[model samples]
Target: MARASVSPAPPRVSAPDLPRHLKRVEPARGADLLQATLHLSGDVDLAHSSLEQCLLTADAERVDLTGATVLDVAAKDLRIASMSLRNAGIRRLRITGGRIGTLDLSGSRLDELEIRDVRIDYLTFGGAKGSDILIADSTIRTLDLPQAEITRMAFVACRSDEVDPRGLRAKDVDLRGLDAEMFTDANGLRGTTLTTFQIQKLAPAIAAGLGIQIKD
Candidate 1:
């Protein structure tokens, strides 16, 4: 009988190294935070409050905001790592000039989300619903929207490396000023409204997907 072969073990994945200042603290309900740095764990509820220049780091749990408003919030070196928001009903939420790593928003509803001059890595909106989601002057590495519903999504002067729109139900998606390098599923944008220039930019990708040869 032949000897059975044993596969090698896979490499272990480790979590990110958090800073010393990131502690587990809870904020007052409906408290306003300005120019503060806090490391939080578990669920956080900041309902009906405003935050400006706030550096916040949270654990794997979701940040709950039943009704809150966030404006001009940023972290040290303008980078936020591993933040998740769930069931957050936010009004006038604006994140200007920051770098976010692993930002997840699930089952949340936002009136306006204006992310400007920011860099995001692994941004996901899973099972969340939003309207008027705008990303301006930003660079996103990976944008994943699985089973999410978005209405009137617009990208202005923004660039994205990969946009995975699997099971994403969006209406009126405007990509006039967007420079997307790769779209995982072009058919996912079947009902999207794009400008003539935008269509021209994506012609090559579209042709490649359809396996059509463009002969001059």
Candidate 2:
């Protein structure tokens, strides 16, 4: 007997729409914006700008904030192709939901970086220094944190396809609710805290790394 043909999966849905009637502001150096809604279309260069409780709708292809300072900012509901924060300082950087292609924070300093409910294609924190970093309720395709100096790193209810934490030096690493397909160079997380369930899930990988055979 011949079997029936299966239908193909549907295409992925696009991100949500951005807010309308966002006030346009001239990109200036050291500008302080509070509770403002700004929109960007082309490449944005915000050097030394302070954003407090502001909503940024990034429709731009690239956002370059080299040598800038961002605080208490929330970015959501937009599609940014690329974001670069080289040599910038960020505190309380909360990104709730959005679709970001790539984020490069090389040589930057961050106090608190919180990312929740977002989808990122690629993210790199190489040569970056941060204190508290939390990634909760997000889906990341690839995350690279090589040579990062993070004090506290927590991954709560996050899923990642690939996480490369090689050369990462963190004081406290907590992996409470993380479901990763592949953790490259997992030895970087030697001092991390994992629950019994997480350990059970990673038993095969741990055993392979330690050259221990599991017999039935």
Winning model by lDDT: 2
Tell me the tens digit of each residue's lDDT in model 2 across 1-216.
898642221112122233444455666557877656777668887766776656677778988777777766667766799987787888777777888899888789987788878888998888899877788788889988888877677777888888787888866667666787877875666656767876777787778779999999
Residue 1 error, candidate 1, Å: 86
Residue 150, model 1: Cα distance from true site in angstroms: 0.9
Task: List per-prediction Cα lDDT, in the order shown.
Answer: 0.64, 0.74
> How does model 1 fare in lDDT?
0.64
Q: Point out where model 1 deviates above 4 Å.
A: 1-78, 195-216
Candidate 2, run of 10 with poorest lDDT: 7-16
The estimated TM-scores of all candidates read: 0.63, 0.76
TM-score of 2: 0.76
State the lDDT at 212 in candidate 2.
91
For model 2, name the residue pairs that clash. Answer: 48-68
